[model samples]
Target: MPGPAARDAQASGSPLIDTHGRVHRDLRISLTDRCSLRCTYCMPEQGNEWLARTSILGLDEIERVARVAAASGITTFRLTGGEPLLRTDIVEVVRRLAAVSGPDGPVQIAMTTNGIRLREVLPQLIDAGLSRLNISLDTLRRDRFRDLTRRDRLDEVLDGIAAARDCGLRPLKINAVAMRGVNDDEIVDLVEFAIAHDAQMRFIEQMPLDAGHTWDRSRMVTRDEILAALSARFTLTPVPGRGGAPAEKWALEGGPHTVGVIASVTAPFCGDCDRLRLTADGQLRNCLFSTTEYDLLPILRAGEGDDAIDAMLRSCVHGKLPGHAINDPAFLQPARGMNAIGG
Candidate 1:
């Protein structure tokens, strides 16, 4: 049964629509900011500050916000983190969220993990109604993987991926960040690996979300270069019907398997974006590159009702910019890096 907030939303309409006419439906909730690996592209090896345990949203608090969001017409929720599996109560988190239903029905619960601990917790997550998965895999080589992630757990990630596939996670997505002189040479190899594993391969353009703030446009691999490199190795027919999905996909060899490229930099898809982010500490972000945040934790902790929560969310969406102005000259990277921002 729909709660009051949800019933109100249905009675009227989703209050999540922005000035651009984009109805926000996807919510990326950061479970925690403490990660297991210090991926070079994501964060530094040391001196990284973790959010205070108390400041982080509690289980009930998270459920309250999610319930309000579900009522606001958030149909999909992706659990992300420094590494969500690190949370001791991750399964319980999933279970609680799985129970929240939106106007469309029970909200689709997905997760984006580093895959280091996926094998151990996947069964529990699946049982908790996790509907989809996206695992980060930059390179197939062990040495490169270690160098990229600064971790010697490449084997563990691979094992987890295998376990996920074996468990029948169809169209399993493997996300790889393409960097010049980093994993660019292995583009074809990664696709082949994904095909062998029966998983979809997605190459992402390294955005300006690194902790170091040293992202050089020249060093970052552009979408064209990635497509060109792949085109030389295999036949790629463009897959149509790309709506709001960040990835632009192509049918590989005209068959079931496909490859995707999230060209966030060169080819921005901000106009069709339907995502909102909730940081681990309970701040609401309208866009991934949004400079401003609407803090919801304080209100949640103050015993505010769902109406207040829903109003804050509606205001956040109402103030959303037409697009992330990365191409604009005055663009400034958000103070929080991707790790802290719930990417």
Candidate 2:
């Protein structure tokens, strides 16, 4: 991947594409295209026909992509998956990516996990140099949680979060995809839960990412709506972490820690977008809403080196849509499983 200077060059004097835009800085990588849960919003009633286990990216491939990304001025990244933890050698991948060095230095490594297998991997992952964990916990109610996630592991996830907290993982972020009349009622409760435990909570607005995600504007519990509910109990204070990333961060009124809202649907942050994504099999997606991907696997498997992958990354970033047309009534994300796309 082109370094920051080179990307800047691509965006300006030597435009990477038709326009002078060099945004897509955060690259979320999918280590595995499989998840343990079938959340109604993320999967079909009939589960996804996942890719064969052997087809997923190997550790070396993952390192190569990270090396390219790190080389290209890209420094911030997160590991996502059907469930990143489900991958057998996730710690090794984390170690390898964290090991990649840039002119400025190594990139930051983080992961979005389901938190089910977290207890088994927290210490090892911390040892591997992962700095952040975004655990998906939509509901605090056990029965409701089982109904939402379509599984029975709320206790396991909670335990995982507790274990992660104990392991000294600073800024451990808990992600809850708010659904109206479903999990929306739990917003304040969830925030309080996080406050009591001193963990950061983030309520994500359901994006129209996939039909399987069951994307519905009606279900979209907006940022204002969530914040309003929380404001009733605790005095809410805003934290200025918003820019390109999805979440708009805020600290609780009287609490010691903070919380966030990933208002992707209701409030799109496309203009400030600084993120890209790499699927496990080596397809690079520029915009989450647009399904077009530039294949890096063939280029990599063909024995092309970093330069080729870097160019591919540049092309992907260059080709990225300035902003998704999700708000348009005609907007429709392509039919691809979220797991396959590194959700």
Candidate 3:
């Protein structure tokens, strides 16, 4: 039997839990691999897994993982999925995660959803301790939305966004992927929608990490492009994410709210990459674009114990490269998409 890695043991009062000096302040755990729709950027339109019905992390597993993650340093956690709402007992999972208070401090509970089923479950989720929402909505045009997601029910998503606002997930965030020549035209529209809703919007640059890598850099919508487009009509002032973050943020000129830009391709933000992903099956991934991951469940489930799990995660984070070189021509996206990887 393989002995547990030395980094797994958490000393009595050691505030640091992982190798990256990361206190584990934030965690994004995937709930399922099945999604109702496959956005081009996230997965293929057809010939993909639909009945990918795996036994999602049981509620007890989620709770246990949260406890382990918190003990190591993660103070905030977000639940994601092929579409998290597709899970059978997501509300219960949120309830459990929300109940966690890390040694670093209280954990901030959040979720990243597609917004299709949000309307039906918004109230339940908010009541379960969901504090913030990051809804993926690339285009505002009804036709374009249907074309992009291959689903005609744009109204459902729109309604879901409204319901989330009504439920008071204050300052809801709208995340948009800036695809060249496709939804790029809707940047201004998305901005206006956020301003109208008093929500914070994020325009993310499509990365090479997608199956949609056949993109044209000529049409690549850089953060500068978006700022310029919005600046023509509204002045944008800078408001960086969390801690002088990479997502270049700006408030619209004369607009009531601000927007954020995620440029992972044209510009890679790997150095300050404080993000890590935990897949539905219990693999902790240090970088979304990296091919490496440390399997915690197999060992822990095999009875290696909590200290072992903690040390394993520490070695994983320590082995984590400064930042992934995803934009390089040599870069090839992992066979798995965002959904499979726990977007």
Per-candidate Cα RMSD to the true structure, in Å, reads 3.7, 3.3, 3.5
Which numbered prediction scores highest in lDDT against the true structure? 1
Which pairs clash (backbone N, Cα, C closer than 3 Å) in model 2? 1-310, 2-72, 3-73, 4-73, 25-274, 34-82, 41-213
Give the per-residue lDDT digits (tens) of candidate 3, residues 198-261: 6888988776555545545666688788777888877777764546244777767644577888
lDDT of 2 by residue, 1-343 (tens): 8788765665421323313454445789998777788788887646468777666778888888877777666776799988999888888888888887755688888899989889988888888889888889999898998898788888899999889878877787888888899987788888878766568888888877553656768878888998888888777777775666677876676547777887777777887877788888888888787768898888877898777887787778768776788888888676676777886
* Pairs clashing within candidate 1: none
Cα lDDT for residue 20, candidate 3 = 44
lDDT of 1 by residue, 134-241 (tens): 999999999998998898999999999998888886769999999999899999999999998899999999999987887888888999999999999889999999
Off by over 4 Å in 3: 1-23, 50-55, 211-219, 240-246, 254-256
Candidate 1 regions with alpha-carbon error over 4 angstroms? 1-15
Candidate 1, position 206, lDDT? 91
Candidate 2 local lDDT, residue 215: 72
Worst 10 residues of 3 by lDDT: 5-14
